[model samples]
Target: MTPPTLMSMMIAGGLIGLGLALLVIWFTPAQPDLNDAVKRLSNTSPHRPDAEASTVNGKERLGIWAMRTLPVGLWAKTPTRELALLRIPLARFYGDKLTYAALGFVIPIGLATFLSLLGLGLPFAMPVIACIALAVVMFFLPNYNAIDDAKKARIEFNRALGAYIDLVALERTNGSGVRQAMETAAGIGDSWVFNRLAEELNRSRWSGLPPWDALHALATELGLPDLDDFADIMRLSGEEGTATYATLRARSAAMRTAMLNDELTEANAIGERMSIPGSLLGVIFMAILLTPSLLRMIPG
Candidate 1:
């Protein structure tokens, strides 16, 4: 057999194997064990829907399979934390990464194969290298997106939290207890962040835990150190019999100022970035305008 024929057969076999694997995965029922079902039922939070768990599609199933089969312990841990902060489930996060990586691998290889079939005569190693490089990059793309999303979510949550602190302080000034003030403030807002607070507070009420404890637990789970600090302040008010109204108000004000400073810093950075493109355009324009004059002076 010719070298080209052997290579073609091998590629064909690989494609067939991949297709069969996908088909098998698609047709297979993912039976939830008793433990998984119980865990799913018990883990429902008011702020996030249970429907997210039920909405897994075939591609996601494939990704889940990949995640289960691969020994990606170190790689999965960091992204899992980031995804949790973004309120994305671990299964879905893994699925997204796997899907991106698959696309990255398939696209370059397919393109190279098409070019080869069209007689482009490219070297074999180039496509293999490109496929690996693209796959690695695409695999990490979801992690980057999750990090950016988590950062934005934290910023928004902090802003809402500041407002919540102010509300709680106002309620406290009106003679409400710490818990009552937190519940009242949380109930006043329709935002997701506020809803999350209300959910945690309600859970604390149900579980016989203190509101501060619930907030601390949530902060720990979501990697929000600011929430932990707020929890500490509440703890101090409850345990030390301190007047917390002024403290809450001051904290709210400080948070707002910090947020404003961050916004201004980001705005200035964006303005600086905008100047770079403007400068590049100016240079390009100058070059275009000068090119003809320079050519004229070339003594042609």
Candidate 2:
């Protein structure tokens, strides 16, 4: 066969072998339920019973030795419940209940020994160490993904908040009070941002708290100063009569401008940080370019 064909066949064969190995693990009677094991690993036990699995000392001693030789501790250390809730399918693609952190510890050592036995000219130890290091990084990747999702959600919510404020102000100008404007605006807006506000307002009304107070509470939880300011203005308007719509519109514009400025400043800071690496690379490149000339000019 051609070189490309041969390489494809080799890759296919390796994948088939891995599939068989996984199948064997799946069929093994003693192997714990992959889902259950992953759950135990993630440690999201809302209601774990006091009972622990009892180990028999007689014939099970051999099994205990076998399990200990494997990276069971690393596997056990994974909080399975959290990973299950996270629902990152990428983690399951490698092996369910198998952590990347556990992979380096398990795979590289096993691989190096197998390769050494086959007399392959491979750096066994390095491959093993590299696998382990990679796994360690993969373990925490879900946290970063969650943070990115939250940031996107927050930005969308903020964008929608400005429009919602304008709609409420328009209703107020039509002779509706603060609460009435909020209720009317919320009823008309079908967006998720509005839905969230409506739900909070509904809850506030049911709980005997003012809708403005609920808005302020949500703002505090979300760390949105603009929403908090709107809530404060509304609370004041209830006592001081309907004259704060202009102030609300002005605040909304100012908040939007402030958010834009913050984004620009952050972009500039990131640009500066990026430059440091480029400057270092430039210095290294110039030094390399001048190396021969400097050597020749130096002594003789």
Candidate 3:
């Protein structure tokens, strides 16, 4: 074929490919987000405004689009409980992961281009390997971050819950009902945990669901056994009209003790790890000091 005809064919093919890509993007329906569906079903749970379909940001939409396009097995499993505790939307988390993955994909190409410009030809496999490895790492980076953040958040939530239990007990001793004590205790603290509690309580009240049910759901979603126990305690009080001052106080004390023990154990492990480097340094110093003497003692 003549060069001009070949060029014309290539151009037409490129245009056709571009057109097909645009058609797919514009016509494909976005996948329904499971997290949003669950939240919609649960009337009393606090819902983030950004989790709504209409309010999704560009990055979040990118994430949802990728989720829809990719095979289910190819994507990392969604970290629902961690996301719930952190109040991070599933769409936003996916967005962050995909954004990192895109960066991972682009970086190797950029580096290869720069090396090519410098007259350094990398093997074909190098960039491909770097791209896959980095992309996989970057894709899962958000999972690690979410899990770590959730671990810390759980600690904070448990600590705050202990304090809250104390406050509730105080309110109950002052002749307040279960609902009134919980609401009053939730409103007392200024931390995010307290704010979350207050929001859920208010939402439950508005939705006409019992406050204990909301608390229990929140606890189950976030995997908070302490909160679940607190919910059960409140449920008992709410239903049986029983005084719960002693039970609340006992739970609070046990929680505080467990927290203290965990802290101490963690500190001991950290101390053990810290000692290794110092011991190694000391051994190196002794070896350095003894080297000349040992050499002199050897028959020369």
Error of 1 at 194 (Å): 1.1
Each model's lDDT comes to 0.78, 0.62, 0.82
TM per candidate: 0.86, 0.55, 0.83
Global CA lDDT computed for model 3? 0.82
Question: What are the runs in model 1 whose C-alpha is more than 4 Å off?
Answer: 1-4, 31-50, 74-77, 281-300
Supply every candidate's count of residue pairs whose N, Cα or C atoms clash at under 3 angstroms. 0, 12, 0
Q: Which structure is stronger by lDDT: 1 or 3?
A: 3
Off by over 4 Å in 3: 1-42, 46-54, 296-300
* TM-score result, candidate 3: 0.83
Arrange candidates by TM-score, descending. Answer: 1, 3, 2
Q: CA lDDT of 223 in candidate 2?
A: 57
Position 39, candidate 1: lDDT? 52
Candidates 2 and 3 compared: the better one by TM-score is 3
